[model samples]
Target: MSLYQTSPAVAEALAQGRPVVALESTIITHGMPWPQNLEMARTVEQTVRDAGAEPATIAVMDGTLYIGLTDDQLVALAQAQNVAKLSRADLAACMAMGGTGATTVAATMIAAAQAGIAVFATGGIGGVHKGAELSFDISADLPELAQTPVNVVAAGAKAILDIPKTLEVLETQGVPVIAVGQDALPAFWSRESGIKAPLRMDQPAQIAKAFAMRRALGLPGGQLIANPVPEADEIPADVMLPYITQATAEAEAKGITGKSVTPFLLQRIFELTDGRSLKTNIALVLNNARLAAQIAQELSALP
Candidate 1:
């Protein structure tokens, strides 16, 4: 069985040594409702293309690791029910068992590295969850970044998580936490997280150089590029805090745990925000896609 399959556009780009950005499929399957998910996926891919790179959206379908999806495949995945949420732990096992799954940030990074693509774009990555000290419910995304050599571009850890603890964990693991165009780390739907980013890069090319230098120096892991949501699209951290706190309290009261916690909180927050969070999510994802493409282009230009 083929270990992976690349879409025609991605294959051609690889063959021609052009820039290619990998995208995770979980946002389509688990992050949003149907038609909007489909629309966002297409728009993100087009944004990368418009920025002079090919977009390779990775997923596992019927035991195949797809580096990119055809239009029909994308629609099918978006509308499909009960898609497995894949990560580093179960990616190959799911494929070996001929299961269908949507890739998360961690799984997408692994897939991108396997496919020789060095950059990935997503809305936000999972991190240390609230009450992690008690529940020990850290995200696989952190460990995946510790080992996978694929640079990830995102808004930040989802604002609903324990952002301070997330930063501390990243520090302990020595993962590069970079804020793009600012000194403050970004929260997913908000422009600021009120925490200082360990590093700041004002240019996409500079960020690309940092990735290249790490590789050249035989570094094991990749960098995290935290790009803030556009100001006009932001929900503002102060305004969002109360809603997140209330939603998190509800989760704790109901004993929501593991994978269910995030989606639950997100859905509750959505209801609380009257559906504005999803709109910001789509915008930030598109922004990350554009930046990831530029970084990929710069990497391609490097010796």
Candidate 2:
């Protein structure tokens, strides 16, 4: 028996050598609430399709690594309670145990590479948490980018994280962090991180060329393309910083540690921001999906 399963849409696209954008499932399961998650999932997949590529939404269900989810599967995963959030550490373990899981950035990249999908789109990737020097609570997504060949597109590190430390860790791990259309790194929910991007690329074709060249040179990891949310949809960084600071402080006070920290912070920010953060998050994710599809198309057009 095959170790994985592929949906007909993805199988057809792959057979034709067509471009396909890999989407992480955690955005559906853990990123948003039920009906909204389903709505976002459908909208994102449609966004990719509209941008001229297939959308491969990855997850593990009943011991099968599904490269692309069918509509019913998408609905099931979105509404399922207590779905395991799988990362590099336990992706295989979940499969072996016949458990269902939504893939985080690290797990999604691994699944994308295994399926020969070269591009992934998400709202943001996890990064070094605040006070990582003491807790050392860094996310596996950083190291996964250092090794996985699938290019990931995101708004930036979640504003709730330590952005400078995340970038520093990625730099140390030899990951290419490219800001799209600007020199400033984008903060999730905001168009600017207030920190200059280490690298910048203005076009999808240019980004595609870099991805190809890295593969040609046998580079181990992939690129991080930081695509900012549309200005109309973004909240300024300054407006969000205080909320983030407050939320982070609250989490520390509550002793929220490990994997629970991000979700807890996000939920608090959602409340603090009067749900505006989630709206911006959805916008950025849609923007990223569109960009990732263009890159995938550019990649498919290449040799």
Candidate 3:
């Protein structure tokens, strides 16, 4: 039996060798609430379509991994509660148990590669959390990128993570961190992280060529393309830092750890920012979707 199913649209696109961008379902299941999550999902997918690539929004429903969700399945996943957030560690177990779950970056990349999709877009990749020395709480995303052959487009690591340390980890793993059109990496809700990005590319085609070259060289992993949010939509690193600090402190104080840390900090930051952070999150995600689509288009055109 097949372990997964592709939506008709995604199957057609793959068969035709058209560009298809992989999108994660965690944003719908764990990143936002209700109608807004559904709306963001729809908007992000449409943004990819407008930019000339098919969007494959991946998830697992009742043990069946889905490469792309239809509208009804999208709505159902958006509305589903207590959904398991599946990462590399738990994705197989969730599937084995006949469970419903949303794919995190690691799981999404695995699913995308399985479906033969080459690019993925998300708000931000998880990274080495603050105070990770004692907790050892690095995200599986870093390791996944070192092995998965999919280009992941994001604003950057979440602003709340230890950005410098995150970069250190990515470098150690031999993953390319390419910031688009900038010298600095973006910090999720903010457009700048104040640290220099290791590499920079100015255009989608530039990124696409690098991706293809990596494959030609028989490289094992994908590159990370840090696509900054639109300037008008960014919260500005300086403006966002204090709120992030406060929220991180609150999470640490309240004993929030592991997978729960990100959600907890984000909610607290959302409240502290008077909901501005959420707006920025949505904007960055849409921006990443657009870039991922263009990159995918360029990739599809490659020999």
The lDDT for every candidate, in the order shown, is: 0.94, 0.95, 0.94
Decoy 3 TM-score against native: 0.99
Q: Stretches of candidate 1 above 4 Å error?
A: none
TM-score of each: 0.98, 0.99, 0.99
Per-residue lDDT value at 85 in model 2: 93
lDDT of 2 by residue, 130-189 (tens): 899999999999999999998999999998999999999999999999999999999988
Please give the distance, in angstroms, between residue 176's alpha carbon in candidate 3 and its true position after superposition.
0.5
Residue 224 C-alpha lDDT in model 2: 96
lDDT per residue as tens, model 3, 86-105: 99999999999999999999
Worst ten-residue run, lDDT, model 2? 27-36
> Across residues 85-108, which tens digit of lDDT does each residue of candidate 1 receive?
998889989999999999999999
Q: Report how far off residue 255 is in candidate 1 (Å).
A: 1.2
> What count of clashes does model 1 give?
0
Each candidate's number of clashing pairs is 0, 0, 0
